[model samples]
Target: MNGNTERQFATNVYYDRTFDCDAAKILPGEFYYTGQDMLIVTVLGSCVAACIRDRVTGLGGMNHFMLPDGGDPASPVSASMRYGTFAMEVLINELLKAGARRENLEAKVFGGGAVLRGFTAMNVGERNAAFVMNYLKTEQIRVVAEDLNDIYPRKVYFFPRTGKVLVKKLMQTQNDTVAKRELDYASRLKVEPVAGEIDLF
Candidate 1:
């Protein structure tokens, strides 16, 4: 709870009758966490989302991130882990502030697709997926579920309180929108770091 006592929510969402709770949609380079029962959603291409929760307290969060280009292998490893580290830490810290314990956190990860069709030689999808998994492992967080690496775009819906995640893989014809968004996001990272201050939970 920052200065704004009001809870932040997603806007312009079309209600889906399939789920009973209200939905909060997250876009590229954004993340959200809460103790409420509302659903958190996001569409993904090459970017990865780590859905983490404290099983006991039911406090959870999800972060969407793409690793920036690793220039100069000679640079310190910390420089390369910058964006990924920030994404992971923000989500985890928010959950902790909401009463989650570090030892009780479990994770579910999704989205790392090769949908861009060789746009970058570095294979960003693979790197993003690998980076998140390694980061979680290094932090001793157990990943309970994962849907990583493939050629399809996916829509993810996460229920923070219950730790339920529904993933729908889209057909090739329907992937254009997500691919373009993710590609644009990846391109933006090269020129500038993520804009704005990290949201205080």
Candidate 2:
């Protein structure tokens, strides 16, 4: 495993009474994958999550991430893109390591809400939405479903074993927590160096 993978893997495992299954809640820059039947969840504000799984084996995972403030979107190796790349690669590589095949991968993406105030100029939500879609396309992973940029924050629940996702769009009035968390995550990105390179498998 690479350094980034070690640091970014989600560790908040819990049992969800509501779903009667194990669950992992991934925060910004974190990802979770498992071959066992389980739920992976996250809340997003100007960030995105990709729930990827193998159609044949039901092995999969989810990742929550946002590209840092600025970088040339056209340059695949730019700093911001690199952060996004590592977030994605770490999740996909983990799934592959757990016995998922490259040919059977499919994706469902959600989040990237324009709920953050004073961030309209940067279009952070829009950029993140675009980046994930483009990245999946370049990787030849089929996007089975998506709920991209909008003006409301979202709570995403993903069942990797069944390739099922449930998305709840939060009212603008109730988005304070989501906004604050993402804002703090973005600030940390500005100061912390991006995790080391992770090669996609």
User: Which has the greatest lDDT?
Assistant: 2
Model 1 C-alpha lDDT versus the unseen true structure: 0.78
- Lowest-sum lDDT 10-residue window in model 1: 1-10
**Structural similarity to truth (TM-score) of each candidate:** 0.85, 0.94
Model 1 C-alpha lDDT per residue in residues 14-107, reported as the tens digit of each score: 4557897777787777788878887889998888999999999888878787776665423335444567767787788778887999899999
Off by over 4 Å in 2: 1-7
lDDT value, residue 6 of candidate 1: 15
What local distance difference test score does each model get?
0.78, 0.87
Query: Mind giving the per-residue lDDT tens digits that candidate 2 earns over 1-201?
Result: 333532488999999999999999999878889888999999988999999999999999999988888778778888888888878888898889899999999999998888876764678898899999999999999999999998999999999889999999889988988888898888877777767677777
Give the Cα error of residue 176 in candidate 2, in Å: 0.7
